[model samples]
Target chain A: MATFIDGFLWYFALAVFVIGVSGNLVTIILASRKVDLSVPRDSAFSGALRTLFSRFLPDQHMLSRIGIQVVAGYMFHLGLFILLFFAAPHVAFLEENILGFGWTAAPHWLFIVASQFAFLGIIMLWLYRMTNSVSRLISKLDDHVATILTFLVMLSGCLALLESFETLRLLHRFLVELLLIYFPFSRLMHAFTFVPSRLFTGAWFGRRGVDS
Target chain B: MSERLERGLSKLRSQIDPKVKSFFSSCVHCGICAESCLFFTETRDPRYTPIYKTEPLRKVWQQEYTFWGKLASKLGIAAPIAEQDLADWEELVYDGCSMCGRCSMVCPMGIDIAQIIFKVKTGLSAAGFSPPDLAETTQRAVDIGSPMGVKLPALQAQIGHIEEEINLKIPVDVEGSEYMALLSSMEIMYFPEYISALAKIFHQAGVSWTLCSDAFEATNSGLQIGNTEVAGVLVERIVAGAEKLKVKNVISPECGHAYTAIRWEGPNFIGRPYSFKVVHILELLDELLQSGRLKTTGKESSRLTFHDPCSIVRRGGVETQPRHILNAIAENAVEMTEHGAMNWCCGGGGGVSGNERAEPLKLKVFNRKKSQLEELDVETIVTSCSNCRLVIEDGLEANDMEINIVGLTEMLADHLVVDNSQ
Candidate 1:
């Protein structure tokens, strides 16, 4: 059971994630886009690049209105990023199974802190989604599924942190595999799609010489 | 599905290009766009949320483009879009949204919400679910060469009146002129002063300009109605007129969407680059001022403020020109709490002004502007777009707030240091 969960299921999930994401991206790239013939006031390339990073900081006027989401979004994304790449277990696993790399991992204390931030951020975001009328009205079943699935994966990984119990580690691996497969199919695609989305819009506003 | 629903869905599916796909995929329904939208903020109704307004198009994208959606549709598990769905979204896209692009600016994910809303409008328009008044107006534009049905005779009459008053020749169909000026129906019927002002300013600046007898109307009801074919036709008329007149530049009048239709979206609509450059009237004034041709004598002493027309300032990228011109002529020019690219709409853009059904709601949303004005306590509001000026005038009257609205060109002309030599 451990071998099946750790080896074949893991490979299967990774394949699905890779194929699904690539296929969706290719589909998007191949879709017909209207060619703009107007004389551009500014460079579209620079606009796209500027917007790619500029959107990381919320607009000052919007900061007060979306303070909670901004804070929680940063917490969740940064915390998850730290845990995914810098955590000891994740690094070790990636080195053995994927990247053929064994970079220095963050200390155990940092992992705990990062996990707590991720947990708090995700929880707050979900609660806000449920409570805020606009969010509640707009959020779909996909959002809830993605959030709960991510939470379970994170929770299982934390429970298996000590690696003292075989069952907990397997459960964590199973959830991780499930999440990998679900990532491309769900709103989790935002992690990758946000780049091109920003680029397209940035180029548009950039061509118009507006700081969007 | 009925034929109308099928046609609407097909049109929507066609609109689901790379940008739409990317935007939809990136959205996590965080609802941050809601805060940026005036309709949602003023009404506190979730239905007015910018992202929420894209439901019809989003649903089409999902059912047609996504993996699970395709599977569900094949399995008959997903609910297909119906005619009533398109019918329901008419008000949200047409009335609730001014297409001011404010939500587009504030979106954290960088989604062009206004662009998508425009695409959604195309689908609704194809489905024949648009406002009756806007549809009638578009028909008038198609039949009479003007949205308000302002014929060439009427424009010629207005021109004769302006020429008599200004004691100058208002050039009409003068071949090989340097600039061909286009006027909105509102400018001709409601504010002929814009024509007189243009004549005075152009004469003082020694700029050769003419009005195209064939394509004098700049306000595009097709753009407002979300029918690109009609929009393309309108743009082609201007292109043909400019080409025939052999003008080097086409000046868009002091109307918001007209500038958007002619300057920004014109070439795209006609599927080619323009033979001549398109310039907003404000841009020309600013240029003339910088070159020391157009000089102003004195400033208005009243506590005045410059209302940035959304299309001209934000969407059109003529933000600084109006301010430059205003500062040159006004003694006291205050800005709204939120101005420039982030300025609130006059609650009547994107064809909302012509939609009689949207009047009450338009007046209701004017509170956003009313409060902005009340906060500043400004006596006069000067704007570049005639549509915005009219809407603001209506808004002020509805609230019974005694504030005056003036066009930037007319205001600038009032202060022009008339070149006696010319």
Candidate 2:
């Protein structure tokens, strides 16, 4: 039964990750592709590549703007990664199905603490969105929806971690599955879209001679 | 109002207005974007805050939208839209603001205040709340074919005078020219020297280039005016000019908003991209330098810093090439800390250039740049855009700082190996 459960989770994770990541990436690619074909000869492809990375990837110029948000964003993401992948359940799947690399997992106390920190970070982000007019204006329905869903998934996951009940774990698993399924369709796809959007906006402007 | 504006006004209401319902409904006086504004930072006034700047249209939505608001406003239980409101907020939206997307950039929630501001600006333009400068400038553009109202005949006369002085036909639309060189309106008006410099450069490089008499003004006032109809019509003229000449390559002058309008926004606005390639003067010079077709002999002054135009840096992501172009021409090119996409505005961007009323407010907001100049410890500030030069110069004069606000080509053209073979 353990093997079956592990197999199911691994397959589920792979399928959803592939779909969600790729779908968002494709949208990003399409948004950038919607440029005039005639604009490229003025610039070098390499210039576009440099611009793409500098605009999106951590640059000194962007540091001041992204400041606290960047720290909070990274903190929550790191915590989620530890909890999601290094959890015993995820490790069982990883060992049995894919990586086959066994590593010491976080202790229960650490897991609980990390989860709480991630939750707090997410709340901070939510509060930020609610307060900032720019964020409020620009946010789409899907963005808010994704945020709530992700928070619920994290919240449920934390609750399940606190309990020793199998049913509670199953509830957490269901919420995670729903979130994973909704990820591609929702603004949670920022992980995929952000990079390409950066590339496209940069490349388009760079080609057009706005590079002063 | 002209017949043109009458038409523009009626059609503006039909545009998307996507979230009019929720946008007005969901605000709770949270001032997270106070520091996000270059204007607010300069003014330190609560009224000029980013969210407050957006209140005009927000109130419009409220009065036209909610039951309480509609009832109150209709019954005169609340204040109605007034001329003072529009006058006070014009700077908050246009002159005092750069719409740099910095606030959007810094927002932890990624709300995109800049987008809403643009939308409100668009709406405001329809209501004829556009500043006099932009309105007048557009009139001058359409009537005289350039914003400063330099008519074609007078421009031709000016070019002829320069031709007499320099003794070059200046190739005003030679039939077999390979490139149609576009000039921003500013270069054509106050700084005809840059136009001649371009001619000298082209002649030196042995490239066939021509200036179109009909489509002479490359500066699209529509972008500044927040009037898309005027922008669309102006773009139509540019496309028509390009097609008429059938040039393989079009050289865009080193104007920030002009490049954005013609090259980036042009393709998007014109609905389909052009058949010919558009190149900025920097891109063209970079090509010329790479090809060894042209060379610069002299060095620009030391301790020179670049001023990033809001249109060029923030909106266009044109932060590096100007520096590269400057570095090539100058002995020492120092970058301001807020250089490139993060750089502050020159206070003359968007539609603020032509406005007389916004001038004082413009200088007040531009004091930030004055501080940056003092910090950089630079004598000359070389910028890529014409309006940037104009505004930066104005700011310098206002603050009692002595600085020459020079354009990219005006400097590059100075080093031109003038092809005297004409």
Candidate 3:
């Protein structure tokens, strides 16, 4: 059971995630190419570059209105990013199994702090999604599944922190496998798709000489 | 499935370009767009959320395009876009939305919510679910010369009045002119002073401009109704007129959507570039001022603020021109808390002002602008769009706010320096 879970299922999840993500992205890119015949007043490439980073900071006028989302969203994504690549066990695992090389792991205290931020932010955002009228109205089954799955993955990873028990490690691996399998089919795709999305919209506004 | 539902689904499917696909894939359901929308902010209703308003189009995209959605639909596990869904969304897309694009700016994903809503409008229009008022107006715009049913004779009469009052020719159908100007029916019917202002400004500047008798009406109800065929036809009328007169440039009058229709969406609608350049009147006036051709006299002594119409400032890229015109004329000009490209809509654009059924909701959403005005505590409000001017006037009156509303063009014309040498 241990070998199957560790070897077969992990490889299966990875294959599915890679192929599914690439397939969906290819399909999106191939959907339809819209050509603008109108004269452009600005360069689309510069606008695309600008928006890719600029959107990380919310507009000043909108800060008061969207302070919570901005704060929580940034915390969640930044924490997840740090823990995913820089955690001690994650870096060791990536060096051995995935990339065959890894950078310096974060300090133990940093790891604990990042996990706390990730857990807090993810929970807050998920709760907000369920309670907020606008999100409640627009969110579907996929969104909830994605959020719950992410929560489980994070929780299992926390339980495996000691790494003394093989069962806890297997549990974290199992939940991560589930997440990998579900990522491409769910709104988790936003993690990768937002770049192109921002670029497309930015280029459109850029063409009109509007910095959006 | 019903034929109407099928047609609507097809239209929605056709609209799922790469951009729409990217937008749907990237949206995390953050609900930030809700706060940006005046309807949701004013009413606290989730249905008015900008992204939520595109549910019909989103469903169609999912069912027809996505893998899981396709399997679910094939297994009868997921519901297809139904006629009832389109029927339910008609009010949300038409009456509840102004397509103001404020939500677009606030979207962390950079999703153009207003553009998506416009695509939703196309599907709703195809399904015959558009409001009867908008439908009737579109029909009138296509059959008659104008949405307000202003005929050539009516325009000629208005021209006669302006001519008699200003002692200017108000030249019509003059071939080989430098510029051919188009008028919104609102300007001709309710605000003929716009034309008078133009006449005075043009005479003072010594610019060669003519009014095309063939295509004087600028507002394209087809665009307002979200019908491409009708919009193309309306655009073709202006193209034909410009070609016949051989004008160098066509000036869209001080109506917000009219400027968008002609300047931005016109070429795409007609499937070709115009022989004559399309310029907003403000753009033209700014250019004249920059060239020292158009000069202004004494500034107004009252405290005034400028209302940035959504289509012009936000969507049309005429953000700085209006301010230049306003600053040149007003002695003490103040900006609303949110002005310029990020300004809140007057709650009457995107055909809401034309829809009689949306009047109350429109007034409710006007509270956003009302609060902005109350915060500024200004007496006179100056805006460039005639639709905004009229709608803001109505909202002010309903609330019994003793505020004066004036058009920037008329205001500028009043301040134009009398060039005796010219």
Candidate 4:
């Protein structure tokens, strides 16, 4: 059981993660070819680049209106980013198994704080989605599935943090594998696709001389 | 099984470009666009959420475009899109939305919610589910050369009246003029003062401009109805008129959607650039003011605020021009809480005013503007779009608010410094 979990399933998940993400990206890029023939009032590339970064900072006027979502979204995304790349176990796992190189990991206390933030944020967002009328109306089966699966993965990973129980670690690994397989097909693709999505909209607004 | 349903589905299929795909993929049902929409804010109905309004288009995208959706359909599990779906969405797409683009502005993923909803409107139109009043207006626009049925004789009558009132010649079809001006049917019928105002301002500025006798109507109901074929026909009339008169520039009248249809979307609709340039009347007036051609005196004593029309300021990129004109003429030109490009819509844009069925809903949503005005406590409201003026007048009357609404051009004309040299 240990051998299959550590070797075959691990490699399978990694392969699917890599290939599925790239395949989905290539498909999206080739899906349409829209040539705008109108005269542009501004540079499309500059507008795209500006929006790619500008969206990270909410507009001052909108901050009060969307304060809760903005704060919770940042906490979840930033904490998850740190836990994924900078936590000691994740850094060790990548260096030993995938990259053959290493960077210094976050301190043990910081890792604990990050996971707590991630858990708090994800729970808040999921609860808000269930409660809010607009969100409830638009939420699909896929959205709930993605949120629940992400929560289970994070919960299992926290249980496995002690590194003493093989079952806990394998549970985390299996759930992550499922998430990997589901990522490209689900709205989780927003993580990488947001750049190009914003670029398309920004270019359109740029041609019309409006800031996106 | 219906032909309209088939045409609608085909159009929806064609509208699913890469941007639509990306927008759908990036949206996570966050529901942030709800707070930005006045309809949802006023009604508290989840159905009015801007993103939820795109459900039909999104369903079409999922069923036909996505991998899992395609597989589910192949297995006979996914629900097929039916005629009822399009029929139900007609009210939501036409009556419940003003296309203010506030949702587009607030979307964190940078999705142009308004543009996507426009594609949905195209589908609804093709499915023959447009509001009856808007459809009738579009038909009249196609058949009578103007949506309000204002013909050359009527305009000539108004021109004769304005010429007599202002003591200035209103040029018509004058060859070799520097600019060819177009008027909205509203300006011609309800507010002939706009014509006299333009004559007064143009004469003071010494600019050679003429109205096209053949294509004086600037508003395109095709754009409002989301019918490209009819929109192209309206734009072509202006193009033909401009070419015939050999004008260097064409000034779009102070109507919101007319400016958008003529100045921005006209070239693309007609599939070619124009020999003459298109400029909004506000843009031309602002330019003349900056260049010292147009001058104004005697500030308006009443405290006033400018209502930025959605299509003119937000969608047309003429945000600063109206403010420039207003600040120059009004002694106390205040601003609303959310002014300029982000101002709340007057709830009558996107042909809502033309649709009689939407009047009640439009008035309900005008609570947004009501609160904005209440906050400012201005004596009068000035706007550039005639549609906004009329709609706000209706809204103010329905709510029993005692606010006077004026067009920016007429207001500016009242303050024009008559040159003694002339």
Candidate 5:
């Protein structure tokens, strides 16, 4: 069971993740946009590039209004990013199974802090989504599924942190594989889609010379 | 599904371009956009949330585009969009939203919420779910040269009145003129002073401008009603006029959507780059001031605030020009706490003013602007868009607030240096 979970299940999840994400991206690219023939007042390229990064921080007017989402969203994203690439176990897994090259993993202490941040961020965001009228109304089953799935993955990863329990590690690996397979289909696609989303909106606003 | 629902769904599907796909994919529905929307902020109604307003389109995209959505639909697990859905969304997209683009600015995913809502509007409009008032007005626009039914004769009469009052010829169809000007029906019928202001300012600045007898009406009821075909026809009319007159620049009058329609979306609507460049009235005035052609003599002593029209300033990107012109005219000009690009809409734009069905909701949402005004306690408010000026005036009257509203061009015309050489 361990061998099948570690080998075939893992590779299958990776294949599904890659194929599904690539398919989604191709579908998006194939959905052609109407060419804007309007005379541009500013460079759409610069506007797209600026918005791709600038949206990381909310504007002053929005900052106070969306304080909770801004802070919690950042905490979750930054924490997950740190954990996904920099944690010791993830680095080792990537080195052995995916990258074929290894880099120095973050120290154990940083991993613990990142995991805590991720856990707290996801919890607060979910709580807020369930409570806020707007969020509650707009959120779909996909959101809750994405959040709960992510929380389970993180929880299992933390439980597996002991390194002495092989069962705990396998459980973590299973949840991670499930998450990887689900990533492309769920709201988790936001991790990749946010770039093009910002780019298109930025270009639209940019063409009109608005700093959005 | 009913035939109307099918047609609406087809239009919604067609609107799912790469931008919409990407925007929908990126949205996690955190609902931060609600705070940025005046409708939601004022009403505290979750349905008014900017993203929620796009539910019709989202439903179509989900059922037809996404993998699981396709599977669920194929399996008959997902509910198909009904005619009722379009009916329900008409008010949400038309009445509740101003298409102000404020929600678009603050979206973390950078989803253009207002743009998507516009798409939803297109679907509703095609489905025959639009308000009757907007429908009648749009028909009037297509049939009678103006949304307010201001015909060429009416404009000519107004021109005569303005010429007699200002003692200057408002040029009509003068070939080889440097610029051709367009006026909103509201400006011509309700505020003929706008024409007087334009003539005086142009005369003082020594600018060669003409009014096209064929395309004098600038307000696009087609755009307001979310029918791009009608919008395209209206734009083509102006293009024909401008091309015939051989003008170098076409000046959009002091109206919000008119500037957006002419200056920005006009070329796109017609699917061709314009031969004559489109310029907003404020942009022209700013250029004149910068070039030392138009100069102000004195300033207004009253404390005035500039209400940045959403379509002109935020969506249209003529932010600083209004401030520059306003500062030149007013001694104690104050800005609302949320002025400029982030300024709130007066709840009258995006055709809400024309939709009589939306009046009560429109006035209710005006509380957002009322609070912005109360924060500053300014005596007068100056804005560029005639629609915004009228709406704000109506809002003030409804709230029993004693404040004055003036068009920026008319106000600036009052301060012109008075070129005696003419």
Candidate 6:
């Protein structure tokens, strides 16, 4: 039964990842091609390196506590990135099928840390959506839906990771599979949307004689 | 001191049409808006951020209109949308925002924050929050047919006056002209050189154009009064005048917002399709340059820099043509750090320059642009917006700085070497 559950979650996750990754990659590639770099490239190697490093640092400028929602945003993102790269099943799949360069999977203790951070982030965000007038103003039906899905996924991931109970693990794997199928259609696709969108923005702002 | 504060609000709430109220119902506060605001950037005040500035209306929307707001309303938990609420937040809604779509550029949800603010202003105007000058202008536009209150014969006299000054046949209702020349209140009342330039260019290019004396003013109060009805009426007179003459295209002078009002908003407001194409005078000049119909002597001695007016550049999308013209006409056209679409606003936009309550606010805002000018160290600044020209002129005077503010036509007119030898 345990083996069957793992098989189901992995297959669904793989299918969704493949479609989401391809769709977003095509969008990014098309957008990049359409963007004109003909404006004399003022780009420096130093700026590229700094941009790469800055992603790791906190985006402190827009980070005033006013983005009380944004802090939750950062948390969900950070946790999702960690879990995507370092989860044991994901690592094994990446090594065998995709990268052919596998590393040791995160241990139970590490999943515990990731779960706490991801859950706390999701909760803070949920609280914000409920409390803040501004957040309430801008939020759509999908935002709350995404939050509920994330909460379920994080809650289930922890239960499954702890090997807490057989029934609980099945429940977690079932919900996780459901989300993998849903990810492509939802705002969860911001993961894919933001890449070329940022590049498109950078190119346009540069052309308009603006500082991005 | 006696308690003389009116403390009471106006009766505009019941007057607002409900379609606009639906617009106020739509803003969600993701606040991708903060970085897009000039006021937020300048003052560094969180309250000035477009999202924050729009809170009062957003609260009313959330409380009265939305699903959750309905729930809050039923429970008596949410505050009612009150007179004092609209009255208290008037400045925050109108004066705080310049209605620039910079915030809309960054909006992930594609919400037009500026449009929402304008709609809120409309609601406030219905709620009796309009400034006296705006009300006066609307009344003047309705009665005298111009925001500037120029009587029609008086306008024709001004036209005759400019024709004499320029030594050209300035035609009024000249039969079957190629273009219908529209004069903004800025040019008709104050800057005659621009009107003269129009005459000189039309004569030189050999393009037939005539101004209408019937409804001479181009300052549409719709943009100022937060109502499109007056704008519609003003636009109809102009559009009808164009149709009456049977012209090919309409040409707007160097007023930036007025250009947008005529070129873009005119078509949108008037509903029926226009037979004549609407155009900015800069684009007309660019067409003249492209066709080799008009050429500048390329003779200006002052080292110049171009400031892209938000009206012409961002709103009108005529940024390139003006800069192209400026570079062609000037010997040394150096760029200020922020030029083109991202250029800092001259702080005179959104009818704020003419608003008496916002006059002090305009100076504070113009300081940002003034400082940018100081940094560039250019002697002459050429811009395309008329209101920008007025505000920047007021700003320079207030700050005791000496910088020449030349309109595109004024600069173009100066470069014209009329053939006296012929």
* Top-DockQ candidate index: 5
**Tens digits of per-residue lDDT for model 5 on B144-175?**
87888888988888888889988899999999
Model 2, C-alpha of A40: deviation from truth (Å): 2.5
lDDT of 6: 0.67
List the DockQ of the predictions in order: 0.79, 0.08, 0.74, 0.64, 0.81, 0.08
Candidate 5 residue-wise lDDT, A1-212, digit = tens = 89998999999999999999988877776666788888888989988988888888888877887889988888888889888899888888789877899889989888888888888889999999999988999999999998999999888888887565899899889998999999999889988888888999899888889988
Q: What is the TM-score of chain A in candidate 6?
A: 0.73
Report model 1's interface C-alpha RMSD after superposition on the true interface residues: 1.1
TM-score of chain A of 3: 0.96
| List of chain B TM-scores, one per candidate | 0.99, 0.85, 0.99, 0.99, 0.99, 0.90
lDDT of 2 by residue, B239-348 (tens): 78878887887777778788778866787666787877777777777677678787877877667888877666666655666666677789888888877766777766
lDDT of each: 0.91, 0.67, 0.90, 0.88, 0.90, 0.67
What digit string (tens of lDDT, one per residue) describes model 4 on residues B1-422?
A: 78999999988888998788888988888888888899998889989999988988999999987777898999999989999999999989899888888888778888888988988999989889899999999999999999999999999999998888778999998999999999999999998999999999999999999999898999999999888889999999999999999999999999999998988788888888888888899989999999989889999989899999999887877888898998889889899988887899999999999999998899999999999999999899999999999999998998899999999999989999977766
Show the colliding residue pairs in model 6: A137-B28, A138-B28, A138-B29, B12-B126, B12-B127, B13-B127
Each candidate's interface RMSD (Å, one decimal) is: 1.1, 8.7, 1.4, 1.7, 1.2, 10.6
Cα misplacement distance, residue A179 of candidate 6 (Å): 12
Model 4 chain B: which ten-residue window has the lowest total lDDT? B103-112
Residue range B10-72, candidate 3, lDDT tens digits: 788888888898899899989999999999999998899999999988888788777779999
Deviation in Å, model 3, residue B242 alpha carbon = 0.8
Q: In candidate 1 chain B, where is summed lDDT lowest over 10 consecutive residues?
A: B413-422
Each model's TM-score for chain A is: 0.97, 0.70, 0.96, 0.95, 0.96, 0.73
RMSD of 5: 1.2
What would the TM-scores of all predictions be? 0.98, 0.72, 0.98, 0.97, 0.98, 0.72
lDDT tens digits, residue span A62-179, model 4: 6886787888888888889888999888899999988999999999888888998899899889988898878889899989999999999988987898665889988888898889
